[model samples]
Target: MPGPSPHLPSGPRTLPGEGRTAVVTGASSGIGAATATRLAAEGFDVVLGARRLDRLTTLADSIGARALPLDVTDEASVAAFTGALDRVDVLVNNAGGAFDARPVAEADLDSWARTYEVNVLGTVRLTAALLPALRASGAGDVLFVGSTAGLVSYEGGASYTAAKHGVHTLAETLRLELVGEPVRVIEIAPGMVRTDEFSLNRLGSAEAADAVYRGVREPLVAEDVADCIAWALTRPHHVNVDLLVVRPRAQAAQHKVHRE
Candidate 1:
């Protein structure tokens, strides 16, 4: 991406999030939490949803937003979460994670199943439920917090990479399906984001997680990705930022990361 040109508008003349409700899934921690906070600051009536109600509620209270229990993998949970919402102007599909790093030869079918369940199926479920409310908003935004892994393949990353690729295409197909609707489908794909629980949860150990970013001086953090999300969303309604791929300076590509 290139730097903003002087000819472009300095900022949105009207606040897009004002007087509107935004729902953020996976809001209990990491990029999800950061995004929820950023959206709240942007003047959206933000709703935080995750399985961990305690952390979700705490974060919501601190940010002046609402918290609700949500397990996107569970049909009942998703149904309940969507039923509770009265209105939705923005749907931030950030409730996904990578579960393993293994080659196809040593594939763990269960892990692959879990990864797809959360990343692809779960996202589709929640988005489908909220499409009506978003359409009714007159100006709606559907933002997918995707990953650079979605765009590029790598060794020992079949499960995660495949799932994220589904997300990438999902965003593409959605944009085509709703061409003239008063809604925007946006996807934020971040690379080398060093969040607290993302690697830890995937690798199943703290030391293993630390090693993932050990040599990097400044890997992208949760807040960095969150900033990109909020920036893309706060743009003028007509200015549809279809996809934004953000990565730290040290990371040039999935296979190329400067580690000094």
Candidate 2:
């Protein structure tokens, strides 16, 4: 969906990720896709996994990364993806998104279920499956692409906020539990990112999507968050960036945004 990526390092990326293997979920588009491409370009043997095999394959081909079909909500799918991988030096859990923007009183149970499945349970499944390989790596990195919604809630965001809060807690608890392990757990919470499909998918209308970023001078792009993810991983093994919150300059917080 993106134009030719100039961000990728030039030349043939022959094992550019070196021997380090990285797996990214929801990599068919947006943040996940960008993160997979960024990681691959950074010399990490990246595996692009998502439910959409066609798009995954396309991106994989473009970046010379492996493409695998993955649905984080399904245990079998996650198992199959992780089973196919022998080593996982880095795992980017980016498979989740907001479903609806309604108050709790009007929330749809089904939508909430879907949100939790992809955001919380899905992360649990994938991370659990890959923990062994990560531990073996002695410097494994696990990154979660969370959202500002995870940290603060707003009106018409009941289900999404709750789900992301679960993700934030999951990252915190996992880090403490893995204190002695070699694996590092990191969470990147981005705000007001205008991806091709994120707002459109959430609002289900071109006009609604446009309104989400209306009057904003500049919003965070997928590459901005990908840059953060790639940077955190490349750091010395000793440093574990517990949480990194990123927002567009116009967005001071979930409740505060500077609209022109």
Q: Give the candidate number with the greatest TM-score.
A: 1
User: Model 1 off-target regions past 4 Å?
Assistant: 1-16
Report the number of clashing residue pairs per model. 0, 3
Candidate 2 regions with alpha-carbon error over 4 angstroms: 1-17
Highest lDDT against the true fold, candidate: 1
After TM-score superposition, the amount by which residue 202's alpha carbon in candidate 2 deviates from its true location, in angstroms, is: 1.3
TM value for model 2: 0.93
**Tens digit of lDDT per residue, candidate 2, span 1-260?**
86668876867756435779999999999999999989988888889899999999999999999999999988899888888998889999999988788788898999999989889999999999899999999889888888889999899988889999999999999999999889999999999999999878778898999999999989999999999999888888889999999999998888788999
Taken over the whole model, the C-alpha lDDT of each candidate is 0.94, 0.90
**For model 2, what is the C-alpha lDDT against the true structure?**
0.90
Position 112, candidate 1: lDDT: 98
Q: State model 1's lDDT.
A: 0.94
lDDT by residue for model 1 (59-119), tens: 9999999999999999999999999999999999999998999999999999999999999
